[model samples]
Target: MPDSNTKDQIIKSMLNTAFYKSAGETSLANIAEGVNIKKASIYNHFNSREHLIEETCRSCKEYIEQISFIPSDIDSVSKKYPAETVLKGIVDRYFKMHEKQPLIQIYTFIQSQKYFTPEVMDIIQAQKTALISQTEKVLLSLIQNEKINLDSNDVHSTAMWFCSAINDMLSNYLLERKKDMLPFPEKNADKMANAKSDDAAIEKINAYIEKFAELLK
Candidate 1:
């Protein structure tokens, strides 16, 4: 087995490349070159490029989970934090973590390759399911405690909506969407303004989520 240190070094190389480069474009030779190892040495740690991508993706998921601390189970997180505070914190982490970490860059890279490989699609779908599920769990808690109320009986749908809205807003910020791109320049201008308001987290999310938050109250 490759020593743990060498193995870690290899994975780190994958992550750095994963953000800026597509999975299809990321060659093991390039990774080895970056790591100061022979091209053949990559096979010593991972069986193939696909295997390396999978391993790198695993680390990506772990990095997100560890840094965000959004638990899979609701009870693991303390309820003392109000729903607004907790939800805002998670949303803040989603935006700020992407700023401070490689999650979005790597995620965007892999997503750009969805047509090139099934493995990338699988990772994307699994992560989306996990995110929706986690959001549902938290929304359930919020509903139980009377933090937010929904018109729909389906928590799953509303949970998906809540998460989707936040994601759309965040994506707009990342893509730098602006009034010029839309037919309604005024509305688009307002949206662009909202996306940048409040240091790029709170107000943007509110523009997407406040209606739902109002439902909570």
Candidate 2:
């Protein structure tokens, strides 16, 4: 059996290649070359390329969950920190998640493949639902603590709106990154020059989150 370190290397190799290559284009040979391991060695860790890809998708999901700001006990967190502080921290965590290039690459890759891959589609849907649910939980906690003035009746809808808005921001952020990755002709120099800097995009997201918190106050 391959050791844990070897297994991790394989997964890392998959993540590194995911952004620039399609699922079918990511062959075992490419993966093995990335890890400087023989192709046969991969079989010990994963039965096949499909298995490896599935595992990689699973790994990405787990990583996202790990980085996401989903407090296990929302009530406790609301009591410990002011509502604005909690909301700002959540936004900061999201920025950090986007800052991780590998995570962004994996997310982009998963999104691209979701249409053709059932597993990827499931991951996408699951994450979306989880994000909305977690946001609702946080909002409910804040309402219960009298930290925010949102109507309890509107918590679910508000959470959906919040998640949808954040998702749109993240999509635009990804589009900016995609533009950086793709080749652009000199004719598009003006457009490229007009593209927002990563810092600017992040600041915009922060401003939105602050506005959201203020509205709830």
* Candidate 2 off by > 4 Å: 2-4, 22-24, 65-67, 70-85, 175-197
Q: After best superposition, candidate 1 residue 5: deviation in angstroms?
A: 3.2
> What is candidate 2's CA lDDT for residue 212?
90
Error of 2 at 131 (Å): 1.5
Q: Estimated TM-score per prediction?
A: 0.69, 0.76
Listed per candidate, the RMSD to the true structure in angstroms reads: 8.4, 6.1
Best by TM-score: 2
Q: What is the lDDT for 77 in model 2?
A: 81
TM-score, candidate 2, is 0.76
lDDT of 2 by residue, 23-125 (tens): 6677888788888999899999998888888888888788766655665666888988888788777766664566445676678778877877788887888
